[model samples]
Target: MDTKSLIIDTATKLFQQKGYIGVGLNEILKECNISKGSLYHHFPKGKEELLIACLQNLKQAITIDIEKIFEQYPTTQDAAIAMIEKIIKNLETEGTLTGYTFSSIVSEMALLSDAVRNACGELYQEIESIYFNKLTADGFSEESAYSIALMMTASIEGGIMLCLTQKTSEPLKTISKALPNLLNSNIHLVNA
Candidate 1:
C-alpha cells in the first residue's frame, strides 16, 4: 500500500486498540515506520486530520461489508442476524471487537473535536441507513424502519461492548437470535 494508506491503516488499528486520546503520534509513526514529516504531508492538521481519515476509511470499509451482507441475504432479518454473527465470529477469533467498531473513539474524543464528532456521526448514520433501507425494502414503513434501524444499531454496538467486556460472544449470539423475533414483531405491528 501507499504511504498515506499505510499510515491510515496503522493509525486505525492503533486507535481501535487504544482510544484516540490513548494513542500518540509517535506510536502511529513507529507503527507505520513513517516520519512526522510524512504524516503531516498526508494530514496537514496532524492527529485530528488523520483520525478523521481513519474514520472515513472505516466508514467505507464497513459500508461495503453491510451492503454485501444485505445483498447476500434474502431479507433484512437474515441480514441483521448475519451482521451480528459476523461480529460474534470476529470477537471469537480476535478475542476482541476493537477492529469492528469505533465506539471507543466516540466516547473519548467526540466531545473534544467537532470534526471528529461529525466524522463518527456520519459513519454511524451510514450504517443505520443501510439497515433502514433494507427494512423499507422488506416492507416496513419509513418510520418503523428508522426506529428499527436505530434499535438494531444501538443493540449491536452495545452487544459488541458486552462481548468485549464479558469476554464471551453470548451477548452477540443472543442478539442474532433475537433479531428475527424483533423484526417479525415489528412486521406484525406494522400490519396491525
Candidate 2:
C-alpha cells in the first residue's frame, strides 16, 4: 500500500481496537515510519482528517457487502439468516483484519465527533432499513416487520460481539439451527 492508504489502514485498525482518544498521531507516525510532512501531505487536517477518511471509507466498504448479504437470500427471514452467516464469514475471513464495526465506533466515539456519530448512525440505519423493507416484502405487517427488523439487527449485533469476544463463531453456529423458528407465523410478538 502507498503512504496515504497505509496511514488510513493503520489508523483504522488502531482506532477500532483502541478508540479515537486511545490512539494518537505520534503512534501512527512511528508505526507508519512516515514524517508529519508526509502524513499532512495526504491528510491536511491530521489525525481527525485521517479518521474521517477512515469512516468515509468504512461507509463505502460495508454498504456493498451488506447489500450482497441481502441479495443472497430469497426472503426476509432467510436474508436475516444469511446476514448472520455473512457476519461469521466476514469475521473468519478477515481474521481480525477488519477489526470492528460502526456499532463499535459509535460506542467508542459517538460523543467525540459529530461527523463520526452521523456516519455510524447512517451506517446502522442503512442496514436496518434493508431488513425492514425485506420483512415487509415477506408478508409481515408493516409495524410487526419494523419491530422484527430492529430485533434481528440487535440480535445479530449481539451475536457478532459474543463471537468476537469469545474467539469462536459458535454463537453463529448455535443460532443457525434456530433460524427456521423465525418462519413461524406467531413466533414474534409485536405491540400493534
Candidate 3:
C-alpha cells in the first residue's frame, strides 16, 4: 500500500479497536512500522486528520456495500433476513464482538468531531433510506415505509450493541426471526 493509504488503514484499525481518543499517532506509526515523518506526511493535521479519513473510508464502504445488499435482494423481507444472517455469519467467523468497529467509532468520536459525526450520520441516513425504499416498494405506504425502515434500522443496530455487550449472538438471531413480522406490521398499518 502507499504511505497515505497504509497510514489511513492502520489508523482505522487502531481507532476501531481502541476508540479515537484511545489511539495516538505514535501508536499508529508503531503499528504501521512507520516514522513520525511518514505519518505526518500522510496526515499533516495529525490524529484529527487520520480520524476524519478513517470515518470517511468506513462511511463510503458502507454506503456502497449496503446499497448493493438492498438491491440484490428481491424483497424487503429477503433483504432484512439477509442483513441479519450476514451479521450472524460474521459474528460466528469473526468473533461475536469483533466487528462492532463502526459502532465503537460512533460512540467515541461522534460527539467530539463534527466531520466524523456528519459523515457517519449520512451513512445512517443511507441505511434508513435503503430500508424505506425496499418497504415502500413492497406495499407499504410512504409514511409507514419510512417509519418502519427507521424503526428497523435502529432496532438492528441496537440488537448488535446488545449482542456485543452480552457477549452472545442470540439477541440478533432472535430479532432476525421477527424481522418479517416487523416489516409486515408496516403494511398492516397502511391498511388500517
Candidate 4:
C-alpha cells in the first residue's frame, strides 16, 4: 500500500488498540515504516488530521455495509440479527472486539480537539440514523421506530463492549438470538 494508506491503516489499528491519547506519532511511523516527512506530508495537521481521515473512512465503510444489509434483508429483524452476526464474525477474525471507530475515541472525546470529537459524534449519529431509517422503512411508526432503533443501537454497542471484555463473541451471539424476541416485545408494546 501507499504511504498515506499505510499510515491511516496502521494508525487505525493502533488507535483501536490504544485509544486516541495512547497512540503516538512515532509508533505510527514505526509501525507504518514511513519517515516523519512522509507522515507530515500526508497529514499536515498531524495525528488530529489523521484521526479525522480515519473516522471518515470508517463512516464510509459502515455506510456501505449498512446499505447492503438493508438491501439483502427484507425485514428489520433479519437485518438486526445479520448485523449482530457480522459484528461477531468481525470481532472473532480481527481479535479486537472494540468497536472499530468511535468506541475507541469516545473516552477521550472531551480532551480531544473539536474536529476529532465532531468526527466521532457524526459517525455515531450516522449509524444510529441507519437503524432508525431501517426500522421506519420496515413499517414501524416514527416514534416507535425511533425508540426501537435507539435500543437496537445501544444493544449492539454494548454487545461489542461485552465481547471485548469477555474475549468471546458469545455476548454478541446471545444478542443475535435475543433480537427477534426483543423486536417482538417492542412491537407488541408499540401496538398496544
TM-scores of all candidate predictions against the true structure = 0.97, 0.79, 0.90, 0.90
For each predicted model, how many residue pairs clash, with residues at least 3 apart or on different chains?
0, 0, 0, 0
Error of 2 at 100 (Å): 5.6
- lDDT string for model 3 (59-124, tens) is 677667667778998999898888788887887787754433378778887888888788778777
Best by TM-score: 1
lDDT of 2 at 129: 83
Task: Return the TM-score for candidate 2, rounded to 2 decimals.
Answer: 0.79
Evaluated at residue 50, the lDDT of candidate 3 is 82
Model 4 clash pairs are none
Task: Compute the lDDT of residue 148 as modeled in candidate 4.
Answer: 80
**What is candidate 3's TM-score against the reference?**
0.90
The reply for model 1, stretches above 4 Å from the true place, is none
Off by over 4 Å in 4: 98-101, 189-192
Report each candidate's C-alpha RMSD, comma-separated, in the order given.
Answer: 0.9, 3.3, 1.9, 1.9
Residue-wise C-alpha lDDT for candidate 4, range 68-187, written one tens digit per residue? 887699888998888778888888898875344357586676465788778877877887788888887777788888888778777877778788878999988988988888778877
List runs of model 2 lying over 4 Å from the truth.
Answer: 1-3, 90-100, 175-179, 183-192
Top lDDT hit: 1
* CA lDDT for candidate 1: 0.91
Give every collision pair in model 1.
none
Clashing pairs in 2: none
